[model samples]
Target: MTTLKKDSLLKGTLILALAALVARMLGMFQKIPLDYILDAEGQYAFLAANNIYLLLLVIATAGFPSAISKMVSERMETGRYEEAKRIYKASLVFGAVSGLLLSSLLYFLAPMYATDVVKKESITLAVQAIAPALILFPIIAMMRGYFQGRQMMSAGGISQIVEQFARVIIGLGLGILFLSLGYSDTVSAAAVTFGSVFGSIAAFAVMVYYARKLKKQDARLAVHSSAEARAALQPNLPYATNSSMKLKFRAIYSEILKMSIPALITSMTINLVYMFDTSFFISITEQVYTDERATEAFAALGTKAQSLAGIPPILAIALGSSIIPIVAAAFARKDQAEVNKQTSMVLKIVCLTGVPVALFLTASAYSVTGMLFASPTGYETVAMLCAGTILQITMMTSNSILYGMGKQKQTMVNTIIGLIGKIVFSTLCGYYFGVAGFIIGSTICFLIVTLLNLRLIKRDVTLHVMGKKWIPYLGAVVVSAAACWGAEYVMLNITEGIAEKLSYLLTVLVSGSILCAIYGILLLKLNIITAQDVEALPGKLRGPMRKVMRVLRAGQSG
Candidate 1:
């Protein structure tokens, strides 16, 4: 295959971020229907099973994909195409075997885990239903990493959309059908969980189709290589000769394990915190409240509050994933200037997006939570969680930078330290304060990790955060927060004629839009986003943004 131009950081981030936003929207829509279908107890069960599924899935695949991506990119940088191909092939085998084995373990152990460990026998079906998806996800992850390593995000992004779309459609359909048929809540939840399996299958199909097409393209290019060069760079020579492929596999696997184990641990840090909550939050609450109340509290915190809070960080996650390969390539070339530039750009974008989102969501937390979930019970928790989004975005971006800079072990250490803190804080606070305690604990944990990461970045790269550079973003946040709060207050006072739910919806929608406009204007007026920044926008947006910037600039000059 012809080597494509390396994707610029802005273009790559925008591509993945847009895809992530779409996927996140679909996910949010799915949750609305799910919350409607599953009562508090059922939602608790669903989240219980899902938390375990995610934790296991992260353990099985997270590290290898990242490791493969980094390794492949590093090799490709040196024009060692054959080595990169070998790494890809080896990772595919490893992913398939590990996925199958771990999936089997989960499927069989679901009963014990639900009944014995989590003390929730009702989640057995849900856990078992999601087990099959585990088998497909790792393989899919490997393919995504392959494309991401090549700095081609289209395949991965498209597959994510296809996956989430299929999951929502099939999962929701099955769930509704089961409920309509008068099935038990457990059975209905199980049916919904099966959606993950279908989604993974659909995603796998897309990735495979793309993989085969790319393989053929690469094969045609391979024919052009000279015979001597081909012989010297035989990636699959062991298969052709008397040498055992097992030995080659062993070597590749060892190298992958060395590189990936730390990443795996680092990746698991967030999920580990979730699992900690899943294990402790309800159990601790049960000591002070009835089982039913405990379950309701867990559902509110895990399902409603955490889910709503997660939306803002979708961009950060995408930005994090996209930067790994870009930064890695720059580091490979010893391009310190490019590394610093990319790092600074990513931080600015994260703060610009994340700060406003955190502020607006926190300001309008009750309305947003009520509008989305039909209840504002967890509004305070959601507000606190939303307040933590800035830290989450910063932590994710910094972690990715460290991972790309070949500091995976250091990142892992930082995550471990943070995870330990989370466990300690969550355990103590959850036992004492229930849902509010968990939110506070989580927010504090994120702060700890983000601060650690920032310190490390400064020490390693001599990266400086100038107050002048961030003042505009902070100003924008202040302005947006004030606007949203004012709009929300006005809507509350004037919308007495409207239905309560309708009023909440209107308050959020109207206030959110006004807040966005105000934020954008403040950003321009403060000169936070320059003409050059507008030029870097996607082709369709650039022209309009440029015109707006021109008018704004003219006004300033006049």
Candidate 2:
């Protein structure tokens, strides 16, 4: 095999982020059609079932991928390819057993879970339909984790695109077909849920193909290495024996679990919060509204608004995912400087992207919701949720940094505290304030978690993120958001009766574009992002950044 160069951490992150963006778009599109096809009742059922599926899925596999990636990278850094391969093999076994067992449990208990837990009998079929995907997804996650450990991100990226593509085509196609065939809404929704199974299978095939190709290359490299070693009379060198291999496997397994369990609990926090909403929101809303109205409210807040609000945070997720292995490798080398540098850069980028997106979403909630989801029913909820998005993005990046530094236990503790806050706030707020209350609860939960994680990260590393320098960035976002809000207000008033939907779309598109441009210009002018920052961007982004810098310079010179 050709010797692999160390991947540029930023480039790897950008690749994953681009793929994540596409996947998130596909996910949003899937929801739009599904929401249209199924009424609010069906959408509620689907989302309720999905929450259960996500919780189980996270419990089964979320942490292993990051743990495997970190472990594999650490081993590879020391030239222990064989050990890394052993770690991968052991993880596959663990993934298969756990995935199948959990999948079986979900499949068998779908009725009870839907009825007793979610209090929605109509969701049972959807839960069952998604169960098989859980099995395949965990295995696929392990494969992706292995590749990520090797710093070969293309396999994971390609598989993600393929998976999302297959999901959109198959899911929407099947849902429409089933609806056309006059199936019950539950059945039609279940058909859409099957798309997860098909998508996971597609993703699995892609990963397997890549794995086989990699194995061939590794085999050739191994043969060449053996020949060279023999020729060099390296007979006394340390080589893996069967007994030693068993000991190594034991060590790897223990370490894997040690690293993965806390991470698993930390990841499960988000799903747990969602599960809380699903179980409580509808019932709580029914106290104030009719059952039908409650279902609509649930669909608006939990399904439509939640999905739309989640789009911007994909950047943070991608950044966090990429940070794990990169920071892990740096930490393994005891390079505190590199670790701090990567952590700070990741935090800065998250803030720079997150703050503006949060402010824009909050400011343009009505128009954006109208344009994206065909109505602004839950615009207030979405606006509130955007605050949580910023907090959650920052918290996720912080958690990744902690995980990289082997601080999963502390992160898990913080997540548990946040989870408690979520349960208490969501329940209390939902009972009194309905959907808006759930949104507020979520914001509080994320804020608590983020602040706690930030404190821990500060103690762990010399991170200087969001310092005095970030004030200008915040100022730019605030000014731009205010300008966009004014522009939107004018546009809405001017286009009131001619075409409401068209007006909303135009207001959002035009205002969003102009304001974002203004924000970028202000960031440049305020020196919030200097030339060094522009140069630090990936090559593709650096050119545009440089052009912005040039414009700023010209404005100053003139």
Candidate 3:
């Protein structure tokens, strides 16, 4: 690709990444009030049902979009533009039909699925509440994937924002309105689920607008082509003579299912860890705590604790998504040096970003949870989850890197081992410490997986990611922890009410930022990110950094 083209591509990807980050921020803020608005049990029911819906969406749409995009891009690369257009059109229709069928089946079977397979009585009501949303969600996922495949990320970004915004506005607002009128939490949870359906509908509308625009563009392009060209580009019309349309649909179904299986396995293996943990944690906690207050706290802890520990995982997703394509392309070209450099740099950035955040959370778990949740019922849970966040970030990045390097089977094995470890440890911990055990189990699993990935990296990739680099990371953690603790103490003395809450949050944020700056400088002082590294940021940022010496000179004269 030309430099300009590559730059444009990078810019688009960066924009999408930023959009995802902002959307996540919005999602968290949206959930914060919802958690308060509905209370623990209500939030649990809503999240529980939504989790099932998410799993189904991932399964149904896992590899279809990526595979579709890859196919289209490959066709375009080979100069078969008309054929690519035909493939895109076929994929769109296929996605819509399949999404509809899948959603219908799941929506109808939701109660049975929850009661029989999940075996949760509480989940039954929530599942029924979320059923319609599940039904409509697949179509939205497909549209999202289709756009992503077409490299039209802006449409996907807008759709995501629109979807989440609708969920927050309609779900939270209506639920709060109902609560003010004396609706029970259970009913509010149900309303929240219904809101999800409306949110998906809104996203679908936005997607249709973009899809139609794409269709217009495609039609304009088609007008320039000869009739013979269009005719030649069409597939053999698939089963011309006696074959029914059902056969064609079935063929499309089979194709999507075949590709989706691996992608499903890959996606599920990654997500199942959390889903099973969710069930296991809730079950184990209910067993340990017969008291209603304790049980409620246990259930709520899962949300608040997970929320507290979620920052690293959120940031890791961004790093992982960016790194995967880069690593995949490098592997494709057999460019070992570039692969090694990119992998190492990405890993460092991940650690540099995650460690301090995790440390800050660990140091101020109680204050952080109190600030967000208006209660300290699960402070211990928050701390344990905070530790897990660190392990999760490390393992996710390393395992993702391995997967990108074409070690899918090894990555699968690592996940299986981690899952097994999580189940056993979580069970034991729950027996010993109740709900807190769930977070402990999570931390244990990620630690196991991180070690496994390290072994793989050493044996297969010749990288030393575990020595001096880790030592510095530890130092940064210590620095961040001290900073947060000190900040917490000082902020607590000078603030009250909303200002106190804001002050505590600002302290945490500032503490984390300072630690990152110190970590980066320490790395440079220790020759990690050196003079050359400063020059490698995006052009816009690099220009400002390059003028630092001039600014320093002017400052000295002043």
Candidate 3 lDDT over 1-558, as tens digits, reads 101011245655665567666655655565567657776667766767666655664553345655665555565555555555555566667756666676577667767765565445555666676666655565666666656655666776677677777876887777777788898887777776667777778878998888777666456436665656544443211111222222254554565555555445555643565576555554566567664654366555646765666676777877776777788889899898888787777776677668767777777776677678766567777777777787788887886688678776676677778888888988888777887676677678888888988788766565644346566656655765776677666665655445656766765566556656665555544444444555656688777655653454455569
Off by over 4 Å in 1: 1-23, 56-62, 70-93, 143-156, 211-247, 329-335, 464-466, 469-476, 517-558
Error of 2 at 67 (Å): 2.9
Q: Please, what is the whole-model Cα lDDT of each candidate in the order they appear?
A: 0.77, 0.78, 0.65
Ranking by lDDT: 2, 1, 3
Error of 1 at 429 (Å): 0.9
Q: Pick the candidate with the highest lDDT.
A: 2
| Collision count for each candidate, in order | 0, 0, 0
Ranking by TM-score: 2, 1, 3
TM-score of each: 0.85, 0.86, 0.82
Q: Relative to the unseen true structure, what is the C-alpha lDDT of residue 151 in candidate 3, on a scale of 0 to 100?
A: 61
Question: Per-residue CA lDDT of candidate 2, range 272-338, in tens?
Answer: 7778888876666667777778778888876667786777687787877788878889999999899
| Ten residues in sequence with the least summed lDDT for candidate 1 | 235-244
Better of 1 and 2 by lDDT: 2
Top candidate on TM-score is: 2
